[model samples]
Target chain A: MIRFDQVSKRYPGSDEALRNVSFEIAQGELAFVTGHSGAGKSTLLKLMAAIERPSAGTVLIGNQNVSKLRPRIVPYMRRKFGLVFQDHKLLYDRNCFENVALPLYINGVTGQEAAKRIRAALDKVGLLGKEKAMPITLSGGEQQRLAIARAVVSRPAILIADEPTGNLDETYAAEIMALFHAFRQVGVTVIIATHDAHGISNIPGKMLHLDHGRLTVS
Target chain B: MKHWINQHTLVWRLVLARTCRNKLATLLIWTVIGIALCLPALLYVIIDNLNQLAGEVKHEPQISIFMKLDADKTIVDTTKSRLEKHAGIGSLQFVSKDSAWKQMQDDALTDNIATNLKQNPLPDAFFIQPKDHAPTAIEQLQHELQNWEGIEHVLADADWAKRLYSILELGKKAVWVLSGLLGFALVTIIGNTIRLQILTQREEIEVSKLIGATDGFIRRPFLYAGALYGFGGSLVALALINGIITIFNLSVADLAELYGSSFILALPGWQISLGITACAVTLGWLGSYIAVNRSLARLNPH
Candidate 1:
């Protein structure tokens, strides 16, 4: 679960990207942040990730104020949440398996355990056969799935995706959402920040809308 | 311990693998380092040769002769020849009153009492050149020169040579210190480079962190990259130094032949190479640690 209390983010040489925004995401809940471009969707996501700090108020991730946490402890906080950007942000040079296995390797989960879990994540994303395939070779949908598999491979409790389905076709967008929904069903929280009405319309979850840096429940 | 080292080894492999992939970049960096490193190597050779030159000079006779103001030209000229035949004399010269006037004119301390003189008033003297310039040998030669009847004073010229030898010693010390500083700068350059790469891959880093990757695990490859750069640069620098040494040997050989000495320009002996390798490894390790620490700090998972 994550909570933002009166959080605001101001960029250098620009107006506030977000202002006094407050929201709470429930455990195991799948939700969407709906807004047009520059509606503070990305800022909210970055704040949640603690990549950027709030200008005002607190960002609480699992009862810890991530914004107030020491700089050295940020990696530990980051380990608890799997984040995906709109671009999939895959290391294009690496194959799907290595990408997925990166977190495991970082965490020192190597040998048979690493192999088993990597296979499991790849299998879960239906990328089992594409383990050795580079992200460039995978179709748009498969790349998004691979990103999601990478996100969940280490079993982070919270998954934050910034427009994971943005470049995907409708069919694949729904399929990716379905994957997020499956993860949500198993008690993992999901936050997807996107502007697509079609993408989140059928998803059964709360929809938080942002307009001019203000977040309001719709 | 074995498992820990194995894990570390894995990180090393990852760093080295990334370095291998960017061979061109690695080569360019190595070249930069090679150029920086070669300065000290060349200096080392110069200093070593100076040491050898000093050793050769130690065998030459050195004596100083004081003058007598009232000494007759005839007696001084006769005394000079007699001193030349002295047992330890390899060579000898007389500093006549006229020659002394010429030296004072060359020194040209204007507005002095010497400028008021019509006739040169300086005394005639003998400058003894001994068979051996070594301190003990020169001392013995000085004693012999002192016993000569017309020799007003006999001394050894210790001040100037000792001053120059001390300066060369300082130059030798500077080489070590300069090399250490340059090595540190290399680490920082490599560190900052790796840190920028990590920052550019922030999302990937965050994703990896969330997957429970330890900071060390994530940093392995960058560290390896640093080490690879350092090690490769050393080799290139060594090669450059060798090439320069080869070019230098032609004239060095000619001059050394004149001096009856043979010298070769070479890398610091094997132990020194070991030191170089250690420095390269340490720099890489430190660089990667710094890069990983800062990047991982900014990456938030929870």
Candidate 2:
């Protein structure tokens, strides 16, 4: 579903962030992107999402050369994936249900269909009873689950979780990884960026470890 | 298409929703915008009324063509005939020298006979009412009448009208300039308000962008908020102008009565509505767009 053919990324500071990076994830594969801080894990995901362009080589998502995709189609391309972040990027003004409903809402789902989807997503994260609770009121783990629910409500073809369990306890982090495994079981491609070896190392999945800025796939 | 409209609808919906949630800030912002918008709109209406009043006065005043005392009776009769036949004369009356003297005698009786004499000095006159009586109109007619044959002088009672009209014109122009400056102030006020809002939402914007929400999605509501600033401000201004007119209408009527005339206050018409609405929408759209785009650009979603 995603292919980075010898991709390289450079930021405006004249510093090379990603150099000669190459990777491929077959459809429905579950994988971990393991790296230390600033090891290009975030940069690779950003390139795949077309947030930042590669300085050299091409990045392909769904067989389309997103490297050459015009500016306008970028948003449409993004609608195909779910993204979870370590920060639980939920709107503070909105309740848990509303935050989870956002992706589907942007996709033009409404009325009975949207409510039903939001309930199911929230329910999957074990947050069914807390729909009306505001993000500011939720615990850290609950907020993380809400962000995950928001990501998966649209059932996007690919899931990119950037340290989705970064700030959680080992118990909560494993729970989050189990949810990602459930998605992979349903044939959705999943790639998680994290250094949580203590919590997620025992889980069965391909691990792509990065040192400096180059990936070592195993 | 319904799809496109829904996408765009988020901008407006979010604005209103946020306003409802955060009423105090929204209200304060709207009030600032209203004050700015109201000044210009009120001036525009007053200037319009001034123009109308000027038009009315232009069609009401007349001049008199006084014949020379040395001129013959035949010349006076011929002059009266020429004045009567002229296009400039809305109406003309041949006031014989005797009647002119009688009018002076009657006026003198009201005063004292001792001061009345002075040799029945009034001359035979042709009272020429021009087609238009505005200050400028009468002045033009005065020059044309002076060139007529057998007439020694042409004088129109238009000095005060000319001075008042010119003064009012200048006042109207001043109002226009003041309103324009106020319009700029309104834009700046709303732009600054939006800028602050952008600053407050910086973290939320970074989250949205990082999650793949496009810049347009994040900006939709802000644009709507800016539009509402202008729209709400305009409506407030409309109310303000109406209130001012209501409070001053009776006094204005009383002032006009001093001139032996009645005056009425008129409500604004469709023109004012169109002008205010257009000004509001333009300001709102531009202000929000600028604030949203700049802030969003600075936010690195990654």
Candidate 3:
């Protein structure tokens, strides 16, 4: 479960990125944050992941006040959410397996147990066959899937994505959406930020729309 | 506990892999650290040996008190009693003027001069071994005895020992100063090396942080790498010092033989070798800790 209560964020020397935004999503729900460019979608996702604190108001996840969390506790707090970046953020020098193993390693999981979970996550993303292939050698869609595998390898309760399919074609984007749908079906709350409205029109889920840093509809 | 050990083992493996990946750079760093440590180690060894030799030579400093020629038997008896009661005098032996002349005449080296002397000109003397071997202590005793009744002069044969002790003291101080400077240099070298490593691995660090890696987790590998470098460097330094000592001992043996002595340079014992290794490892750890913490703060300014 995630909730933002009248949250406002403003960067120094820049206009407000998000102003007085509030929303709530129940457990095991799939939600889409729809907005145009510079519409505060990434900023909202970052706040939920505790990567950035809100300038005003509180962001809560599962009864924990993320805005009030100490800096020392931020990393442990972040472990609760799986984050997929628009750039994929995959280390290209390593093979797909190592890329996915990053989250597990950070969580202090290793040995055959980590290997088993990594393989399971890769199998979920249909990247099981390319575990040893380097990320740079994979196709764009495969690389994105690899990133998704890395995100979910730690079995986080909530999944947050900042434009998960911004660089993918429609077919790849649909496949990525289906992966989120599957995660939601298994009791993992999923929140994706994207400017593309038509991409999620057929998928039954809650939609929160933003325009010019203001939440217009929910 | 098992998980903690697993994590450390994983990080250590990663450090080893990275070190192997940059063999030339690692070797160069080790060599630099080795030479830096070796300089002070060699100096300490030489100074330690000299200190041992000085200890042997200055075991019991002696003072000779010669009585005035005109002093009578009663004067000699009074001086002997005073010396016997003195706490600073360990032991003493009296040689009367008549026996001294007789012994001189009996000796082959001094018989010619002794036979020509019409009267016995030797003065009564007390050969006193001081309780303390310290040069200053022996000199103080000599001064105290020289002012005694019927005593002509007091001679303490500790001047050469004092000079050697002063030189050895200076050498010890030099070794300490040199070790301090080189220790600082090693820290800087290791710090700079770790900084470069952090810079090159900037991308990996960023990605790791983004995915919930703790600062400690990220710092573990670099710390291990720095410690390994230090460990390797200390080994090289010990080897170099041992080799040099061996080579020098070969020549030292011949030189000692020429001087009718068997003194040879001894390698530093286990305690000292372990101490050097521990110091080097700590410095390496400190250097990498500072480097990684600084860069991590900059990278994640939350």
Candidate 4:
């Protein structure tokens, strides 16, 4: 579960990124936070993962107060959810299988057990046959799929994707949205931040809209 | 225990993967580190061998006292008694002038010459072995003997030993200085290599951090790489030194044979080899640790 009550984030020598934002998404719920550029969607997700502490109020992931969590515990806390980026942040030097295995490797699961999980995750995203292919060699859609496989490889409780389909075409964006829908059906809480509200509107999910650092609608 | 093993095994795998990724760079770094470490270690081995060789050339401190031929038996007896009472004397052999003349007459070349001489030219001498072989002790004994009654001269044949000892002392100091400088060079070499490695893996580190990888997890591979550098360098240094020593021994073998010396060069003992390897590995690990921590601190993942 993710909860944000009166959460605000401000950068030094700049205006506030998020102002008095309040929202809660229960376990297994799928939601989208949409706004224009510089609308603090990325900051809101960062607060959930404890990447950036809220300037005021509380951001709670489960029962833990993420804003006040110890620095040493931040990494462990992040393991509860997977994060995806717009650029597909896959390590280009390694093959697709290695990239997907990153989370499992970090979690100390390896050999046959890790291989099984990695293969299963890749198979779900239709990248099972391209396991040996390098990221640079993959198409734009396949790369985004590979990133999705990596995010769910560890079976994280929550999935937070920041503009994951920004670089893909209309068809690939719909495919990514369908993948998120399928993950929610399996009890994985999913939250996505994107500026293209209309593209994802056709999918059935709660929508939280933001405008100029203020939460305008939920 | 199981968790510990799994963690270490994964780290080692990562290290191997990265090392294999850039074979040329790894080899270059290892070679540079090996050369830096080899200089000091080579000097140490050479100094140790030289000291051992010098040790084999044993020289005992002995003072030879010459007495005047006209000295009376009474004065000679008194001088002998005084020497016998002295604590510095280990043993003394008194060779009388008549016996010295007789011994010279026994020789084939001096027999007829000694028979034609009316008086014996040889003087009574005492071969005095000192209790202590220290240079200062022997010098003190020689000075004390020169002031004794009926003694004309006291000669201590230990100048060569003194010079050799002084040279060995200077060599020890020189090895220390050289070792210190080379040690600093090794640390720098390892540190710079680790820094470059950190730069190359910057994105990987950032991604790992975001994906819930701890600082320890991100640093594990770099630490292993550093230790491997030190470990590999020490091995290469050892091999290089042994090869050079073998060649040196081959060239010097004939010279030693000409001198009729059974001396052969000795390789460093196992303990010393292990010590050098351990020292190098520790330095490498420390350098990598410092570099990785500094870079990690500078990166703000958020």
Report per-candidate DockQ: 0.20, 0.46, 0.71, 0.68
Mind giving the per-residue lDDT tens digits that candidate 2 earns over B1-302?
A: 76567666655677777789888877777777777777767776776776677667763466877888877899888887777787867988789888876665667444366254667566788876788766677788798878877788988866756777777778778877887788678767878888998888877777666555777778877888888888888887778888887777778889889877676567688788778878887888787898787786667433
Native contacts, share recovered per candidate: 0.38, 0.29, 0.67, 0.69
iRMS value of model 4? 1.6
Interface RMSD of each: 4.2, 2.9, 1.0, 1.6
Measured against the true structure, the TM-scores of the candidates, in listed sequence, are: 0.71, 0.84, 0.88, 0.88
* Candidate numbers, best lDDT first, in rank order: 3, 4, 2, 1
Candidate 3 residues B1-302, lDDT tens each?
Answer: 99999999999889998999989999999999999999999999999998998888954577888999999999999889988999988999999998998899999989999889899989999999988887778878888888888999899876777788889999999999999999999989999999999998898999888878899999999999889988989998999999999999999999999998999999999988998899899999998999999999999937
Q: What is the Cα-based lDDT of residue A38 in candidate 4?
A: 91
lDDT score, residue B57, model 1? 58
Q: Write the per-residue lDDT of candidate 4 for residues B1-302, one digit (tens) a residue.
A: 66578879888887898889889988888788878877778778878887888887766767889998788899889999999999999999999998999999999878999989999999999998999988888989999899888999899877786688788888889878987887777777888898998898888998999888999988888888889999988888888878888888886788899897766677878987998899889888988898888898988554
Better of 2 and 3 by lDDT: 3
**Candidate 2 lDDT tens digits, A1-218:** 89888888888886777878888888999888998988888888788777778889999899999879877677778878898876667899779887887777667776577899999999999999999998999988899889889888989999988998888887888888899999999999998999777677788887888878887765
- lDDT of each model, Cα atoms only? 0.78, 0.80, 0.92, 0.88
DockQ top scorer: 3
Report how far residue A47 has shifted in candidate 3, in Å. Answer: 0.9
**C-alpha RMSD between model 2 and the true structure:** 4.7
Residue A208 in model 3: shift from native, Å? 2.5
